[model samples]
Target: MKTGGVLLQQKTKKNINITIRNLTISDITHQYCNWLNDKETNKYLESRFTEWNMQSLLDYYHQKNKSELMLAIIEDDTGTHVGNVKVSAIDKNHHRAEIGIIIGDKNLWGKGIATTAIGIVAEYCFDVLDIHKLTAGAYAENLASINAFISNGFIVEGQRKEHVLTPSGWSDVVLLGKIKSQE
Candidate 1:
């Protein structure tokens, strides 16, 4: 049972298409990294991950090793990869893992792109994987992410001061968690 649990935690072959696909080498060569490296995108996570080069993105993808899968977010109707999401650090034993998402289509901001994607992915994480909980953190400055997480039923677990560093300096981080109800 333990070994089975470990295997389940590492499973990553499932590629869910629909506003999200596993990135390809072309994405980096064509400047998909630019979208990811933008400050607006980084506002919630790394302050300057723009350091990642094309080869680095490629190598990182190759090195991911089934521990997690990173998917490219694309519009279902247009097939344009506008964002990305990752369901990683899967712990079948603890039945929890972190969830991260981003919608880079600046024009689509505040239009519910994120809200819908959250529902899609959360359903997969909780319903399909039977994972008991999902967790996420957003920089205190990123109200959009905070609202989306809250709207999706993620409970505010806590806050950490100076948890994120930006070019301007340190910022707070809001921790959130969603545990599946036994009901």
Candidate 2:
């Protein structure tokens, strides 16, 4: 496909009426699934899920136990879905959570959209959500994601060897973390 899923989820100040709100229903279901399942895109992601289609998406949206949270990322000027940011396991008591970003739109890659999106979400995590610790695991082979996370105040915790696999083989996973205390 033409990465229509990415385009579908993008929500920025320029698109839609809710300028400051995150991408909601427009994203949760179909947006990332298409790119995430693609062989090329899956190369960088740690996990690849198989159970997805239009019907599966609809089913997933109705579930009450979903702990994961996602937000669509759009370019400031063009209003395009270059990627997305996510967080999960939001423990209000612990004020900790796992966070992630996925920039499958090659055309916008390396242009700082990922950085901007991450920065905004991290602010939301610490400032709005009052989360103390925000963390993520990246495929070690994906240096771009590592740099993006690290440059955004996230520090490397360690590397886990051969912890994940793509269609081809196993790859190491790197753990990164940041705390509101550090900021």
Candidate 3:
């Protein structure tokens, strides 16, 4: 089902069209639920480790916590629900937050949509939310994810050795950070 959610913000490019918007109740579709369960699509995601139920998602949505901002990532031309970008784990005292993205549409992989999504969300985190810094982490093997953040002005800050277990073996976590410019 189409979210028909209000367009809170956007960032566009020739190969990528990102509509940053709030998620709606209608977004709880079978397609949305399936993405979380798709092993291949979620291989690099932390969510892949847990199971998601529709009712549980709905409950979480209704809880109305203000610590995070979750935005829907919609493909412009096809109006497909490709994924979501979120700025969560906010620390107001530190003026920082963490960001994450999940591009559920495997067909759109290798495209620049993920990078554009990060740019849009990071802009919001810095400009609108007044966050001084934004941080994210990716598995050592997830080059695409690392590139996306790097292209959006993030830099590798540190690495956590043997952070997560993968099929091959344990992998390090590449920590990334981007600070808002004083100017």
What is the C-alpha local distance difference test score of each model?
A: 0.69, 0.66, 0.80
Q: Choose the strongest candidate by TM-score.
A: 3
For candidate 3, write residues 1-183 as lDDT tens digits: 112233644544555666778867777677877888888877778767768779866776566334467678888777777888877878878988899888888888887888888987787677777889999999998999999999999999999999999867899999999999888
**Best candidate (score: lDDT):** 3
Q: Write the per-residue lDDT of candidate 2 for residues 17-83, one digit (tens) a residue.
A: 1112344556554555676766767677643556456666555545522666656666556556656
Q: How do all models score by TM-score? A: 0.82, 0.77, 0.88
After superposing candidate 1, which stretches have Cα over 4 Å from the reference?
1-18, 21-29
Ranking 1 against 3 by lDDT, winner: 3
Q: Write model 1 residue lDDT over 1-183, tens digit each, in one string.
A: 011211111111232235544655555444566656777776666625656667776776677535775666666556577776777778978988788887777876777666666666776677667778999888888889888888888989999989877767899999999988677
- Model 3 worst lDDT run, 10 consecutive residues: 1-10
Which residue pairs show backbone clashes in model 3?
none
Please list the residue runs of candidate 3 whose C-alpha ends up more than 4 Å from where it truly belongs after superposition.
Answer: 1-13, 63-66
lDDT of 1 at 17: 35
**Ranking 2 against 3 by lDDT, winner:** 3
Candidate 2 achieves a global lDDT of 0.66
